[model samples]
Target: MLTSLAIRNVVLIEALDLEFGAGLSVLTGETGAGKSILLDSLGLALGARADSGLVRAGETQASVVAAFEPPAGNTRAAALLADNGIEMEPGEPLLIRRTLKADGGSRAFVNDQPCSAALLRDLGGMLVEIHGQHDDRGLLNPRGHRALLDAYGRCDAAAVASAHAAWRAAAATLADARATVDNAARDRDYLTHAVEELSKFAPEPGEEEILAAERATMQKGARLSDDLAAVSDCLTGSDGGLAQLRQAARRLDRIAGEDAALAAVLEALDRAVVEAGEAEDRLAEAAEALSFDPARLDAIETRLFDLRGLARKHQVAPDDLAALRDEMAAKLAAIEGGEEHLAALEKDVAVKADAYRAAAQTLSAERQLAAGRLDAAVAGELAPLKLDAARFRTVVAALDEGQWSAQGTDRVEFEISTNPGAPFAPLAKIASGGELSRFILALKVALAERGGADTLIFDEIDRGVGGAVADAIGERLSRLAESNQILVVTHSPQVAARGAGHLLIAKSSDGTVTRTGVHALDAAERREEIARMLSGAEITAEARAQAERLLERV
Candidate 1:
């Protein structure tokens, strides 16, 4: 329940603090006595859009505070507060404060802890619902009707949502596979061409490095070929030392027996000739090893160029060409096997779709049943608010396949008929302002304990009705407060008289400044206020007696 409201420097309200209690409370005031200002202040605390014009004439800022205390056995408000990181002791009140600066900026706080405006709005929703002529939040939206109906019927919406999601997942997976097959079919010629081209001479890994090294050696050999030829000329050409060495050896051998010195010289010359001959053999081997092969170099360069060109064309390293060829071959193979794969996916989708359809059908049936019961309950309430001839209905209809969603296939809309023989139409389009308020009140009374929010505020719902009609509205409001707290702003004295607690809205001026004030009426104050409400500007004795009788009834 909304325990209290405080406003500071907002519009004509300089400073106002009022505490509230359980059950139905009424705020009564004369026209333009700042009754709307009180609601605006409460709305500010509830995260309504801020405006600089709300600030008092001389004030730099305006602020509003609303305190909510959950009813016994209700934890939704506390849970919401805790989820927003606002700490509260067990049974502690949740305080929401909103401050607007004159410069078009605003800040919000929950339980004195700074928070975003969004958080305040969300937490506020769990605590209070403010219904008025132009309001679209709360129970007005068609989107929430299904959930509310489900809540009223105790149906498992989660189960239906889960099934819907599973169906979508299966459909998405199947669609992706089908798209892949479609794209592969479109690129079939390209894939086949690529496979054929790569298969002819799939480049081997590391073969490029080996070929490159050989090419470098062949180039170096070409540079050294002339040097090698010069070396061969020095070692065994016409002017070489082999002939001289042989001649010296033979001369030494002939005089070897004449003296020991000649024999030693002959042995030395023979060893030198043998060593020189070995050197000549080694030079010949080196020349043959360094011999250049232009044809072999040309073949190697051609192979390397082809490999590099293929790598660039295919956007892969030479080493990866082999792997790419294998992958393309596999994709082509999958094209052959794709029909079977797609058939299996379609089967899975069918099974999932059937399962989802079953769940949705079950949910739809439940909604139909709940809707009937809801119509009856709300219908029972309408006559008391003086719409006895009105008809209320909940329409549940299936959407087209194109309109299918995770929320299932049914569209839920609230409809009403204002006359006995008229066809029912959309509530928003058919009902007058006063009639809509009564309809909303009836719906709320029917679903009082279904959706949460411990507090409900009606902004002059009894705007154009009085006497028995106003009395009926008061009775229903009082009945609704049995399960939820209710606050009504009214000019109806009958509605005011039915309040368990009363607050009077009055505007006073002190020459320079005018301010709005709210006062909690005591027993005597209540009598005078109710009489004023009944007798207008003059509170006559008959009006006072009537006010006493109204209080006695309470």
Candidate 2:
């Protein structure tokens, strides 16, 4: 329930603080008494769009705050506040505030923690629902209609659980079959190409590295061959280099008896010739062994390029190609096996879908029975609201084959006929403004203790109504408050007298500006206000007596 509302610098409301109590509270005032402004301020605090023009003329900003006292340990409210990062003090009320600047900038706060407007709106929905001529009709929402019907019939909990289980089973089977199909589609070409490529190359895990090392060695050998040939030419292939040295040594040996130093030099030159001859033979052998082969080099280059190209194509290193091939093989095997698995999955989905259809059919039958009762009840309520000849019906249409959904296969809509011989039509299309309000009231009364929260506000539902019809609307609203807090904004004296509490939305002036104000009325004050509403600017004794009597009867 809303415990308090505060406003500052919002339009004519410069500053206002109002507290509310439970049961049927009515806010009554004449037209243009700032009643709509008060509701608008409350709506803004509940996260409605902010308009810069709503700020007071001399003020730069406008602010509105609403405080609520949900039941202790309300898990949904606690979770919602926590999700918004709002702190809740022990035994303290939940505060939601909105600030709007003249520049069109706006900010929202939940328990003093800054938040986005969308988050505040979501939280506001859980706390209060303000229904008016333009407000979103919670009852008309198709998404919630079925649950509402079940709630009204007290049959929701079991039906919802069974339906959810059926849905989960069906969803699981569908997911499995779809996964199989996707895998087959994705892996078909990949497997075929991988198998074909790997069959030809058949690369080993470390073969590329070994081949690369061998290619380097061969290349080095080719480079060394040139140096080896040059050395061989110096030693043996060119002019008589070694032969000339040997001839000189032989001459020296003949003169050895004349010079001892010449004999020593001859012996050293002979040893040098022997060593040089051996070195030349070794160099020639090396040159022959290291001779370049174009064919072998071409083969090595082709293999290396092929390996590198395949690596790039597959986005892997040359060494990882073997691993990639193995992975592709595994995927191909899975796809091949998928056909059988897909068939099994289809069977499973069919079974679960049939089960869901069966449960939905059962739930639909129950709803049909409950709908008959609800239609009869609503029709009975219409007569007292001055539509004695009107007809009410609950239309439930079945889905065709292949048009199934998670929410079941029925479309429920309210239909009405305003005359005795007229055909029933959809409520939104056929009913007048006054007729719709009465229908909404009856439906709400029937579902009072059902799916809705603990608080329900009906804004001026008494519009375009007076006399006995207004009294009837008041009676129903009072009855609704038995299970949920009911708030009604009205201009009817009959409706005002019926409330457990009455609030007057009045405008006060201080010569320069007019501000909206709210006052809780005591019994005597309520009587005088109802008299004022009845007589309109004149509070006669007879009007006061009528107001008092109207309160006594209802």
Candidate 3:
């Protein structure tokens, strides 16, 4: 329910704060006394289009703050708040504030947190619905008719939505699988050739590094082999160093028995012969170890070059060639078996589509039944509001397959026929301004138990009717207020008397500037106001008496 509305510098309303209560509240004043200003201010706070002209004559800006206390079990508003990343505790008030500048710019805030105007408008629709002759956002919009019907019928569309989602997902999966198989089929020859080539060569990790090192060593040994052979010949032949040293040692040993000096010389010659013989053996071993076949070296170099060339061709390092080969083999296998896989996917998609169709059909049947009941209930309410000759209907028609959605493939609209035997047409096309308001009222009363926004504002709904009709309109408004907070901008004394709370809007000028003010009426003040409504400019004794009776009747 709307707890209070604070408006500042908005047109004729300079500064006004109005507190509202439960049940029906009526605002009454003479024409041009700024009753519309109050509604305009409320609309501004509820995210209506902002106009610079709405700012007071000398003010730089205008602002409105509307506070609401959502019912305990209302989750729609809470969910919206959460989706916007705003937190609000249960039973807490939801405050919506809007400011309009003279430059035609505006800002919106919810609970003091800045938000977008679009978000504020959406939240406003969930909290308050203003029904006037020109209202297009609520009941009058054909787009929202389906949701309203579902709410009225208490029908759940979750199963249909879930089934549709599953079907679409399956179809998407099938599409992706088909694309993969088609692409693979186009590349089948390339995959087959690559896999065969890799299997034959069988490149191993680290093989390139080992072969390159061996090649380098063989090249160096080939360069040094001639020098090693020359050194071996000097050490081992008859005139070589080893042979000459042994001959000197034998001569010295034969004279060693005759002199001590000769014996020392023989010992030195023997050590020299032993060292030269060891050197010759070492040179022979080095020659054997350095001998490598040129053919072996050529084979190692060829293998290394082949491995590097293959790595470059596949755009991979030599070490990764093995893994790439395995991957190609797997793709070839999938291509060979793709037909069976494609068949499985097609069957799954068919099953999902069938489930979705069944769910949508069931929901459509329930909506058709709901449409009949709704038409009857609205028809029953028409006669009391002076629309006795009119007929109202809820049209439930199937949409084309291309237009099908999670909402169950049906288009729902409210239609009416203004005269007896006239073909029913859409509400907007057939009814006049006054008849449209009444038709909306009838629909509201019939669907009252279903639930809507906490607050409902009706602007001059009783404008064209009076006597029993006005009384009937008041009675229904009173009934609707039993579950909703109703604020009616009315001129009818009967409707004014039905209000549990009354506010009087009056315009005043003090020599220079004119301004509008709203006053909450007490019991005596309410009676005088209603009497003024009945007698026009002058209050008469009879009008007061009639006003007393009107008040008592409520």
Candidate 4:
């Protein structure tokens, strides 16, 4: 429930602090007494749109702070705070403050922690609902009717939502499967050809580098082999170095006995021949080692070229061709087995759809039963509000499959027939401004303890009606206040007299500056305020007596 509201430098309200209690608190004053300003200030604190015009004429900025004390059992507000990462102690008050500068800038805070205005607005919605003739945020919107009905009926909407989610998940899976299978079917021929080509070529990792290195060595060896052959011929020829050395050594051996010098010369010549022979043998071995068949080299070159060509065609490195081969083969296999997988997905989707339908039907049934009860309840309220002949209906109509949502497959709307023979039409179309307010009140009275904001403020709900009708409205409001905190802004003395607490909004001028003030009326003060409401500008003895009697009835 709203605990208090504080305003600073807002329009005519220089500074005002008003504390509230539970039950129906009424704010009453003459016209132009700044009642609207008070409401606007509260709206601003609740994250309504900020305007520079709201600032006092001489002030640079305006601010409002609204404090609320949530019930111990209310987890919705706690969950909302937790979601936004704002902390409040278990029993602490939730304070929302909003500041508007003259420069058209604004800021919002919850529990003095800076927060987005949107978050503050959301929290405000959970804590309070302000209704008036032009209200669109609450019961006026048809979109919220389903949730309202479910709340009223205690329906298992979560089950329907869960089932819908499952159905959507299954449907999405089926769609993806269908798309995959269709694409694969379109590329069936391409996949088959790719797999066959990659299989036949059978490239391996590191083969490219090995073949390249071997090709380089073989090319170099071809050049070296020619030079080696020439060297071998020179070493083995009849007049080559080894032959000539051997012949000279043989001649020197024959003359070696004649002189010691000739023996030394023969030994040196033999050693030279031996060294030459060893060189020739080493060269032959090297030539054999370096030797490579031209045909084998050609085959290596062809294999390298083919590997590069395939890699280019597939947009991959030659080493990756092996992995690509496996991928294409897997795709081909999936295509072959796609129909069976698609059938299974279809079955799952059907099962999920059936489940969703069952849950939605159950929810719809609950809503239907609740709607009947709601209509009867509202009908009971209509007679006292002077709409005895008007009919209220809760239309829970089924929607098309394409329009189905987590909210279920029904569209709920509150319709009314204002006359006996009139066809029921939408609330907005069937009721006059005064009638609409009464109808809204009737619906609210019926839905009082079911679910809604803990604090409900109705602005001028008893505007057009008076006398017994005003008293009836007051009685209903009192009844509503039994379960929820209610605030009413009214001119009707009967309505004003029924308040657990009363506030008088008044404007005063100190010659230069005019300001609006709100005073919480005491018992005697309330009598005078209500008397003024009954007697207009001047309070009379008769009005005072009537106000006293009205208070006694309450």
> Which structure among the candidates has the greatest lDDT?
4
Q: Write the per-residue lDDT of candidate 3 for residues 140-238, one digit (tens) a residue.
A: 778888988898887789999999899889989889878877887888999899889988989888887888888888887899998987887787789
- Model 4 clash pairs? none
Question: lDDT scores for all predictions?
Answer: 0.85, 0.79, 0.88, 0.89
| lDDT score of residue 525 within candidate 3 | 96
- lDDT score at residue 173, model 3, on the 0-100 scale: 89
Candidate achieving the largest TM-score: 3
Model 3 regions more than 4 Å off = 70-73, 89-92, 197-331, 449-451
Better of 1 and 4 by TM-score: 4
Give model 3's TM-score versus the native structure: 0.79
Task: Give the local distance difference test score of model 3.
Answer: 0.88
C-alpha displacement of 144 in model 3, angstroms?
Answer: 1.3
Comparing 2 with 3 on TM-score, the higher-scoring candidate is 3
lDDT of 3 at 4: 98
Candidate 1 minimal-lDDT segment of 10 residues: 70-79
Model 4 lDDT tens row, 1-554: 99999999999999999999999999998789899898888888877888899999978999999989954555777888888899877788888999999998999999889999888787777788888766666677787777788888888789999999999999999998888878878999999999999899899988899999999888888989889988988888897878888888888889899999988888888889999999999998888878889999999999999999999999999989999999888778879998898899999999999999999999999999999998999999999999999999999999999999998999999989999999998887767566777888899999765667888888888878999999999999999999989999998988988899999999999999898999998999999988888888788999999999999999
Among residues 3 or more apart in sequence or in different chains, the pairs in candidate 2 whose N, CA or C atoms overlap within 3 Å are none
Q: Residues 113-179, candidate 2, lDDT per residue (tens digit)?
A: 8998988777776677677776654665555677777766655446545665766776686686667
Candidates' TM-scores? 0.71, 0.71, 0.79, 0.76
